[model samples]
Target: MNPGVHAGTRGTPLTPTGLSRPSVRSAGLLLGLALLAAATALSLSVGTRHIPLDQVWSALVAPSGTESDGIVRELRLPRTLIGIAVGAALGLGGAVMQTLTRNPLADPGLLGVNAGASAAVVTAIGVLGITSFTGYLWFALAGAALAATAVHALGGARSATPVRLALAGTAVNAALFGYVNGLQLGNLNTLDEMRHWSVGTLARRDPALLLTVAPLLVAGALLALALARPLGALALGEDQARALGTDLRRTRVLAVLALTLLCGGATAVCGPIGFVGLMIPHAARAFCGPDPRWLFPFCALYAPVLLLVSDVIGRIVVPPSEIEVGTVTAFLGGLLFVHLVRRRKVARL
Candidate 1:
């Protein structure tokens, strides 16, 4: 039986023989919740003003007339929620892309999505004079579609094996970023649009901002859920998946669409926050084994947790003057990424 076909007495994929494996998912859920709670507390308590943890909880649960409550509820909460949304999307997106492309190293950063979104947004800012993020989603989605198409053209139908996929994505990423850098250098309006956005912030102007992006995120997520079984089929190799009645073209299109929905909208909202997608899935697959059915939902929970923690770290680590999430995530993710590289181990996505 295929690895996608999990431990089932009746030979179905992903369903174990009854509820015997409860402890595995239970442990994962507990760990994810613990991370989320810790990150939330840290977010509430460790800002420049340094409210106590209890006060942080109070400010959250009991938003009364207190000054600290106002500070915590109004200023900090929205940012935290945005981080959750962005982080979860990236995490899940990265995992699915890797699975679909069969590349453990593939990420929006490694791939063309981030660069495409950046280029599209820059174009909107520089040539079109559109400065609002709400107005930028269409461009971001267009860029991501173009980048993915370029990857398909460059990689060809047979070249989506892990090594080749990453190589193609890297080449595309470098070229696109190069173009974006030139635009930023030559155009003041582009520079203005990207300068703050490039830094990556959770502190959005409105909680309503999240509502705007939520549909894309939710759509991406549901599509990923639908694609998981087919992806598992593909993970066995294209020839095998085809033998199993999985349509490779359909799977690829769905994966690309899901990625565009998730990453494009995310970049439109929060700039190119890198590696949440790359690293979170790597971590998830490390624990959950080879099934995307396992990896997908796990990422849904864990990615937001990672982002919220990272965002919280940025808030408190520097006191009054906080670091941007992109820089913080880059530095931290860079170190972990390097460690993974040094190990030279690719966990099967």
Candidate 2:
């Protein structure tokens, strides 16, 4: 197996660690789920108003039309749920993109997904006068799909290599981002909306929009999970995959479709929150190894932990005002990436 791409955390468990591979993976998975649950509680309880655990629980079990119930049921509940959904989507999307591209640094944004979404949102606000989250959602998905399709076409379709695909995506990302900048500069209203959305906050979210995108994330997640075996086979190299009777074309197409749906839906809802996808897979690999079957589940559980922790931290770090989840994750994930590079765990792709 290619250690860099296919096998992370490669080693036999030592007695000193008090765990075998299966045990370690199981522990990690359990811990991740527990953390997610705790974070969800914290998210519901520790917002600007600071509803107590008891109050949050009361609001959940029995709604009395009180202020606490409104905060718990109407406001924080949706935000927390959206955070979980978006976090899971981004984490899985990043893992899928990196494995398919064989690039440890590959993130959902690397494929122009975020840029395309941004361009669409900016265009909608500026040209179409659409100023609602619901309006942005559909536009973002369409743009992301179009951008991914363009990248695949430019990368040579069935013959595209991961390097070529990445390069094409980078080019498309730059062009779309440039176009987004032009749109923002030309319109004051667009600039204001873009500035807020670009920072990526789960605040002021439309529950309906979140509900609308949930199916896309679910579909994409199922597709990504289904491709685990194919991706594992592909990690062995194209010739080896072909020799093993894997269909490379089918795999790539489905993989791209998965990324587009996951990343697009996430961007549409959360406005391009960064780093959840970039950091979760590598972290999961460090604990459980590089098998996608294990990695995907770990990511699905652990990513919401990271996100909710960040969201909670963002709420508390500044008191009256809060930091954006995107900013917090970007800083933390960038630091991790740098540490990995300095440790030589990540090589040039």
The Cα local distance difference test for each model comes to 0.78, 0.88
Write one digit per residue (lDDT tens) for candidate 2, span 121-155: 88888999988888889999998999988898898
Q: Write the per-residue lDDT of candidate 1 for residues 1-349, one digit (tens) a residue.
A: 5544366445423534333244456677788878877887777676778899888888778768799998888888887778778887888888888898787767766558888888888888888988876777678778877886676567664445545656777888899989999989998778987786677777664677678879988999899889999999998998999999998877876787788788877876788887788878867765577798888888878888777777777877878777888888878887877777667654345
lDDT, candidate 1, residue 89?
A: 85
Q: What are the clashing pairs of model 1?
A: none
TM-score of each model, in listed order:
0.85, 0.93
219 in model 1: Cα distance from truth in Å?
Answer: 0.6
Report the error of model 1 at residue 339, Å.
Answer: 4.3
Cα miss at 294, model 1 (Å)? Answer: 0.5
Residue pairs with clashing backbones, model 2 = none
Error of 1 at 191 (Å): 1.8
Best by TM-score: 2
